[model samples]
Target: MSLFLGLDIGTSAVKAIIIDAEDREQASAVAPLSIDHPHPLWSEQHPDAWWAASAAVLDRLAADHPKLMSGVAALGLSGQMLGVALIDAAGRPIRPAPLWNDSRAGAECAELDVKVADFAGIAGARPMPGFSAPKILWLSRHEPEALKRTRCILLTKDYVRLCLTGEAISDRADSSATLLMDTQAGTWSPQLAEACGISTGLLPELVESGEVGGTLRPELARRFGLRSNLPIAGGAGDNMAGAIGAGVVRTGDAYISLGTSGVYFVANDRFVPARGQGMHTHRHAVPGLFGQHGCVLSAASALNWVAGILGVVSIERFLAEIEAADLPPADIPVFSPYLGGERTPHDDPLATATLSNLRGAAGPLHIGRGVIEGVAFAIADCHDALIAAGASIGTIALVGGGARSRFWGQLIATVIDRPLLLPPLALLGPALGAARLARQASGGGLSHEGDRHGMTMLEPRAGWRPGLEERRAIYRQHYAKLPV
Candidate 1:
């Protein structure tokens, strides 16, 4: 049986998985990665570190699962979006790459808004500090020398792809989020590049997500113990890959991803920009489709913070406590999951989290429940934005690390008041999606039968409606009063 490999260069780690022709996972591995914060509101990682991590994970998979590695037909990549890696003509990174969570370019964002008239209409989203364009502007002002030497600009995964294939190319799905791409046209915008004080020649060539980027370079392939002619798909950004992995290919198909960050992604058949409301309209991994998303800067990360504060040694234990508490609506505290600031609806990077109505008796359990509810409320805010934009949302597929908890799933269902579908392999959303893309690039057709199997559905409990409604009202009131 032919095998496909998928690699995800995520914010917290680099993960790799091998799947057979039937979409059954044969082996998977992950290597942890670190972020640098040299100054306040800054998040950067070395492009070399990403390549090292990717190589390490692939090395482990090849060592332990030789048979799986030997039959690998193709590889696909997915990674965090909006991060920029400046590479010189020699393909070496000139400086550290700013990440998606980086917020040091606030001033540059305003500059772009002024420099590029009709910014939202052209770029398909409002200028935000997390995007590549602002980061480039920041470099232009602060690190002009590095910007001067920069010959090619690549996103996170595309940098790794360069190492593997000796090519500098990115997919339309990832390019659309850069604030430098004409999303509707599925190409880079030279006009936007000029406005950002950068030359258009620096952007990587764009391709469809499932198209072949190139074959693995012979030397790298031999060094990594892989086939020489292995094809690499022009993969996607994390959220778009997650949507593809969840079979959210058609219009109206939506998925809620609760990774380190939260994303509510809806597939649309046509280009629909929601820039005014701080929502995003990005190209989808699937051809000819677009993805509309509302992103929360922190989702499961908020839960992780609560776990640390509560001194819970294991996430399992923390989740157990949440499942057991079952706090009634009136007793639950209200929380805002803005630990990393916010994106959708409110584009404030300085927004701090708030916990309200904490009684003298309130403890970790109440706070935990509140944190979960807060994330749900944030997603509901996004849901409302999509609805306001005239997008229809039906059953939502809930995927990611936080979706592992039955209680959390049910809570989100009640908060959003929508039926939720949980694929058995939901946690592997991006990697699996990347593998599927790899399969397609190799001229293989994947059967949707496997995707439709082993699914669990969670419906909002009627009993929880009253409590959810009451808490939602309080949440909205507090959210409005938050210091922006």
Candidate 2:
């Protein structure tokens, strides 16, 4: 059977999924990786660790199914976005990659925002510390030696693609996150690059998502027990891949992703910068299209913080407790999910998470449930922005760790006033999406019909009030009063 490999490099782990030409899953493997935080708000990872994880997972898949490696038509890559992976002249990472969560470059992002205010018609988004440009500037100013020797700055997937194919290239979806690309033009912007202190030499060549890059090297293929000359497709951003996995490819399609960060993405037919409309714009995985995406920087990370603070005795026990809590009918405490900062609406890195009502009755369970609700509310805010910006959402596909909980999914439906669609294979979200893309790119006979056999629809229960209306008012007042 012909198979395609879809490797997703996330912040916590590297996942490899093997899918047949029909987009059916053959096998999957996951290998965990570690991130280093040398300082506060600084996340870095060794590129070697990623490579090792990828190889390990590939080996595991090959061992499980001997024929899984044969006739591998195409390979697709997906990864956590906004990380800056600098390589020297030999196409090797000089140091650990500074990750998307790194916030040391807040000032640089602020400077870039001011510099590009007038020319924002092309970039389609404001600069933020979580982007590649600020991260690059931080490295250049702090680590002058590394900056001087840097030959190219690659996003996470771009770096991985380089290991597979000798070519140094980046996809437009990931390139849009760099703040240096003119997203509308689908080309690198010299003006923005110069403002960010980045030269064209340090940038990787940009390519479309489905376009072919290069063939796999013989040595790497042999190492993984795969045949040489496998094709590499221009993969996509992690969110985009997740969206695809959730079957969000059509216009007006919506998907809510609760990975490390949370995003509410709506697909559009053409490039529309809802720039001043509060949502950020990025090149979609589907070529010649764009996405209106709203991000909450510390969505799942806020839950992680709660888990850490309350001992890790049993995650199941904690989840059960929160799941059984008495949910409010109309109004609830204002729960701000911004632990590190926020991305959408305000884009403030200094914003802090705050629970408006902590009185004598609140406990860890309340806080936990509130965190989920808070993230949902943040997503609801984004939904409102998309609506105001003329995006008529048709469906809501919820995929992420939070989707595993019935309470959270239902609450999202009520809060956003849309039914939440949870496919049975939600856990395999991004991997399945990348697998589908890989199959299509390789001329695989994957059925594109809307089977949705594994999908579950979560409708709002009766008497589920629109808590978002009150929450929206409170959020606006709170944000207006924020001391930025």
Candidate 3:
């Protein structure tokens, strides 16, 4: 039984899973995480919280399935990307790490846009407040003292890796999106670093996503019910891991991750920087391949927020009833879905959410249905942006927590007017993908791209298109007057 553990340090939680040789999930656990918004546009989580959550998750997994965990051969990691977690020479986090959705670095992003020549061409991602470099730039000016104390910089998963291995390392696939790497060269770019008021020395050593990052520490190994020599694979960022998990390795293959944030990912054989469009052209976890992504700052998170506002306790039941009601287009209000601003296409950091066309009789169902359709429309916007950027679109795979809703998936497919592929383990694709990487790192493979044969497909219904199209126009109208 060659078992592997896959852990994802996501924005909302730390999820850990153990899988066997047949790609069967043997054990799993999750620990919830909360973000801090100290200021209007700030979003942060102490690096300690991630490590704490990770430890708790691992401890639970080990306790629940000690025998299964003891048989684990290796571990793989995956998580959110492109935010700075600064640690000092004393091996202490300087402050709470600014997260990927933090929009406080808007001014710094503009500075880099002007300072770094050919910003998009060099970094393969648009200069945005959500990226890592700008977050560092924001720190450099706002809190120079913190930068002075910083010895090493890490991304979300790498920070947790530092805790697990006592080594500072990162994967190329995750680092490529940091705006500090030369996308074409696949190496740290000193010029880009300098423009962001930092140097390559602050960054961690880069490794291939499937290579051994470091061995687990003796103490943590005992806690995990594993041997000290258990290797941790150089895991990928969520998008890359999600791609590999969904068997999106071949060129023109794509997946739509309806996770905390919405990501439209397309695999490519070569660098395809979609200049002018907000698509990210970066390295893939699969060696020697590139990927393009259209990221929506808020996807499922936006819907979750609206649900909370409506005082709905059971999200599944709320969505079920909304799906049952099948409200007409006129009853569903227009939703902007920009709770934390946006990234793809608009790149507006100040954009706010809006629910328009609300009637006096509008209740939770109307509001809930509106938000659902709104997210689908927002996804369509991502599809259009990627298509305009010349990314080849074929059948799309939908993978994430939001994909659990049949109505939501169908609605999104209808809005995009495309079919969707649903993998059996769609909800935790990144973790599963990380396990796949772990298998590769151990030189013990169990599956191939051809394994996608078991995936189920969701075809769009033409009946829902016309009404959704009319509402999407209203949604666009609201977005056009954004940055409010």
For lDDT, the strongest prediction is: 3
Candidate 1 accuracy as lDDT: 0.87
**TM-score of each prediction:** 0.97, 0.92, 0.98
Clashing pairs in 2: 424-454
Q: What is the C-alpha RMSD of each candidate to the true structure, in Å?
A: 1.4, 2.5, 1.3
What TM-score would you give candidate 2 relative to the actual structure?
0.92
As a TM-score, model 1 comes out at 0.97
Stretches of candidate 3 exceeding 4 Å from the true structure: 446-450
| Per-residue C-alpha lDDT of model 1 across residues 1-484, encoded as one tens digit per residue | 8889999999999999998887888899999998899999999999999999999998898789877787899999999898889999899999989999999999988888888878878777888878888888888899989989999999999999999989999999999999898889887898999887887799888888898987899987776678888999999999998997887887888999998999999998888877666687889998888888899888998998888998978886777887787766667898889887788778888878888978776888888889988999998888888888777776589999888887888988888888899988898989988998999889986335666567899999889888878888888787578764
Kindly indicate the candidate among 1 and 2 with the higher lDDT: 1
TM-score, predicted candidate 3 vs. hidden true structure: 0.98
lDDT of prediction 3 = 0.88
Error of 2 at 189 (Å): 1.3
Q: Rank the candidates by lDDT, best first.
A: 3, 1, 2
- Residue pairs in collision within model 3: none
List model 3 lDDT by residue over 363-458, tens digit each. Answer: 999998898888888888889998888888866889999988978999988999888988887886899989988998999872564447777778
